[model samples]
Target chain A: MKKTLALATGLAAALGLGQAAAQVSDDVVKIGVLNDQSGLYADITGQGSVLAARMAAEDFGGSVLGKKIEIVFGDHQNKPDVGSNIARQWLDVDKVDAIADVPTSSVALAIQEITKTKNRVFLISGAASSDLTGKACSPTGFHWTYDTYMLANGTGGALVKAGGDSWFFLTSDYAFGHALERDTGAAVTAAKGKVVGQVRHPLNTSDFSSFLLQAQASKAKIIGLANAGGDTINSIKQAAEFGIVAGGQRLAGLLVFITDVHSLGLKTAQGLVVTESFYWDLNDETRAWSKNFMAKHGGKAPTMVHAGVYSAVKHYLTAIKEAGTDEAGKVAEKMRQMPVNDFMTKNGQIRQDGRVMRDAYLLQVKKPEESKGPWDYYKVLSTIPAKDAFRPIEQSECPLVKKS
Target chain B: MFELLGVPPQALFGQLLLGLINGAFYAMLSLGLAVIFGMLNVINFTHGAQYMMGAFCAWMLLKFLGLNYWFALILAPIIIGAFGILLERLFLRRLYNLDHLYGLLLTFGLSLIIEGVFRNQFGSTGQPYDNPLPGGQNLGFMFLPYYRAWVVVASLLVCLATWFVIERTRLGAYLRAATENPTLVQAFGINVPRMIMLTYGFGVGLAGLAGVLAAPIYQVSPLMGSNLIIIVFAVVVIGGMGSILGSVITGFALGVVEGLTKVFYPEASSTVIFVIMAIVLLVRPAGLFGQTR
Candidate 1:
């Protein structure tokens, strides 16, 4: 009886070992692309970010460490509670390894906290809040595409240097807007520029005539737009109509995207100086990848957020393959250790505070005559190197940095 | 150099002008809603969607047929009004005997469908509509865009003309009579059903006209109406439903109030209208202009 029991136990142990081997060979990696899919920010990040992630997965040979990569997506509707709920579900229930392209600063910050608690990865691409790296930085969160600090330094500094010394801000009244306004105001001040006056407008305001008039009255040399998406488009369009630019007061778009330029068209958006981390037409690599992306996305060029999603996903997968495990902590560590080299970033490295250092560009919206065709919108003014573009690590004020 | 209420004269006058321009839109939209509700006894929740359709149609006309703003101004209303007629005949006609909530629900559902379809086709990014009348006259105090001035004037003219036809004409009397006693009007050998349908169409046409005027000022977007419609509804409520002159006056007055709020306490600009709405509801439940049934 004892001999028979020993043989049965050995058989069970061998079976368990075999099952573990099978699990190692057939692991699955899941990522969730969460953002405002149906609301205002939908045009900037929505389904396009999903398509970009899918492209990244395909480019990464569809798998990492012999595990098939799967992509999932959800619409946060630009609400913090909704975004946090989805992040919780994606982490606890669905076992999603990462969440990417979260727009709307409030939603992104909410998800960032949830991701930290769950020990999951968050690749923030669309949000522009500097606080993500500042006081609220999470070890599990990597701010990928752009941030308010970069925008303020690039566009605000450039505008100040170009003789737009006096400024008035048409700020969108929210966390994102406040951060942008504060950062740009600081940048303007640092460059010896003065902010004469400012007015805060509600988010998604349809009319800007009154706001523009207020800015016009300030007689500030520059009208700094600390807004994004539809708000930016409306303000720029109305500013033109009010002859703010022709009246000799320039407009500086602190967080303008290529998609906004397309919406406004070169005729109305001409000569508007803006800043971004990536432009599709920056080089052959970006153009080729964007062409592939555009083909799948109904001829809409990939915005920096979409490109950032692609780069983040590809880099995350590479990190997973190197780490040889989908354990969130180890994968995040690997991701930070490795340099991000892709179409979107050149030798970009994620800092201890999880801010991805990347080059930012100052771009001027091309005049109608200068644009060759559709999506030909930007005239690259100058490139701010990765080191100079992002906020310095010593000033990040991140809790994680102190621990590290 | 002078300041009024701590704001520069240019800023104050400019905001007031802006407020008036916004008021023009509110007046036009609420006028249409009042006209439709007066006779149809149906609250058209799809008004905003129809308004959005007007802008989209104008854009399509410009893109496909090379129709300019002037052509679109005339043609879009007629085309959209025809669609309104179809809606009244096929769907709305069935809901007359049911609860009024049914009409609201149906129209609301239709708006969602229309907005969804447009979002799918064009995405949410706005398409720019060229300002037909570019450049503004610097009036020393403020820079007044010709296009903005044109919108205010056009909307006012249209609203007044609508009010005149409804309040002062034989046709309007017949329309009022039909609203009061449709069966009696039908007994008098007048086609009451046809008149009701045409009135709804005309009401919808006013919205289309507003949309066309709005295309240049705001981005031509599927969401343009949805955003403006909520504020317009508040204006309609504050003015009292089914009151023509009340809607027109309240809309303009509220816009100026909102503009002043921007100059004084900018944070309250959005909520000032709602605050007034709450006060009006408490003071006069039927609205400033509406009569109790």
Candidate 2:
């Protein structure tokens, strides 16, 4: 990425543009990471995301095109208004060039509209709704991590193939949950599986037994959890008590992070098949990067969101250097053209619809006695290839995708 | 023989049972609030935090000292109650002479601080507590977990015990006398301040006990209390601010209402409690079991 950026910067300079340093606004390249810093999703993307962007800047030598690289972050608190308010302020008053890592899909979708109108870059590393790249796609936006479509295809498809065919969804009544359910439900239908029933519970609900009872009554072979964070943890915990699993039903965690597994411990989270794009213990490179991250993150492994933040920041800065300017359009084009190469992702492409097309892994949580040590949770089963995994451009609702 | 709104009778029975189980927590929590408001005349807004603290206390007890669920159930409440006694001495005691808002504000701010510290230390993903009784009996219509059944019974026993002590005993006579006229009670040689402080501690203890009951079900997280506290407040208000019997009954009844919402609409489950609270307030300002002051 660095070599490609330098070559592009040189080419742009030769093509009659000013030097990259002179093109930088305010003599600095600023990137802002917006996410939930203080709520239920906090542990997944909160301060750790901020820490990730900083690590990214540091790893990138803290500068691009002879301009200092700066990172700023804010807490959305899982509220869309709060997220957009902070974002508008960052763009107008603070002169932030690009916004990265807005999780909480409702908040992410809101920020998407604002950043589009503002004509600034947006890099999404959180929020699982496939709609970000679907109807809501923007020219300046780039989805770097996982999304609902990939999760539906990865976890949902595999479960159906495994004879956990009949489905019942316990959805969180919000944008992310709705998107996940719709996408996963579609995946089930495509695979000749029947959806028994679905119940949309409010976010942050403490009790899930009533919903679990309804799911049990549906008598579905698989209970597809279309929620994230605390909602997911509670559903799984309560399902155990209600004898949902003991009664021959399987749980499919559509979007489970390592932090969730850590919180749940191997005791309850064991045997749960989850789909995610990145895992820290995947290879030596991931381990080396994660160890440094874990040191700063209180010995906690990086969730895919954290890794996505780091990768997105590094790529965004590279794009700016490559384009020889901080303009949103040129940099975004450069980003889309350059393949995403990092520890967790290999040759990941940013599709025209802003979906980061990358291979995702299907993981099953090892039982309590599977025994390596703490944080040694997942047994990687198979990789869901990028072309086969992501929603094809032909089927996209995104206006950016040219209809053939 | 019967069906209500397209839901089967069997499913309805399961939902009703689930609602009753949820009501157990509400009854326990609102009962604490009523006790404190009835005696202290200051709304104990920290009830949720006290409950969260109780769960955290239980988690810590098991993690650090090898204390089991049974032991933590007894000790977590006492520890949190002792902490509550400290709160009464240090901060809440100073606001008894002022308007009710003062106590509410102080406790609300304190709740933020307490929750903030816990969030910083523990993070919000939540820690899991092992269920003492893991397996359940299949009731044919629904699976009934032994632990959940135990939770309902335990909360009922606690509520009845609290009501008996406050409304029936000799100590209860003096407490009620103090509630009416603390001056006369003090003049009659009763240590009114000490008694008031102990009453506050006891109420907070009830919140802690409810927390222990919830820990096994919901993962122990800092924001766990905040999520349910608003609804619990609605439960208390609809039950009539300081009515013990009112809070106890309203808590359970509202839980069933919320459960039905989850069945029919599902989206309005969180709001149904407040909706009921609004209607109840308009119809009977003093609540179902509350006497007009």
Chain B TM-scores, listed for every candidate in order, come to 0.98, 0.98
Docking quality of model 1: it rates as medium
Residue B91 in model 2: shift from native, Å? 0.5
Report the CA-based lDDT of candidate 1 relative to the real structure.
Answer: 0.89
Candidate 2, pairs of clashing residues: none
Model 2 per-residue lDDT tens digits across residues B141-225: 8899999999999999999999999899999889989999999999999999999999999999999999999999999999999
Tell me each candidate's RMSD, in Å, in order: 4.3, 3.4
- Of the candidates shown, which would achieve the greatest TM-score relative to the real structure? 2
Q: Please give the distance, in angstroms, between residue B130's alpha carbon in candidate 1 and its true position after superposition.
A: 0.7
lDDT of 1 at A65: 54
lDDT of 1 at B25: 91
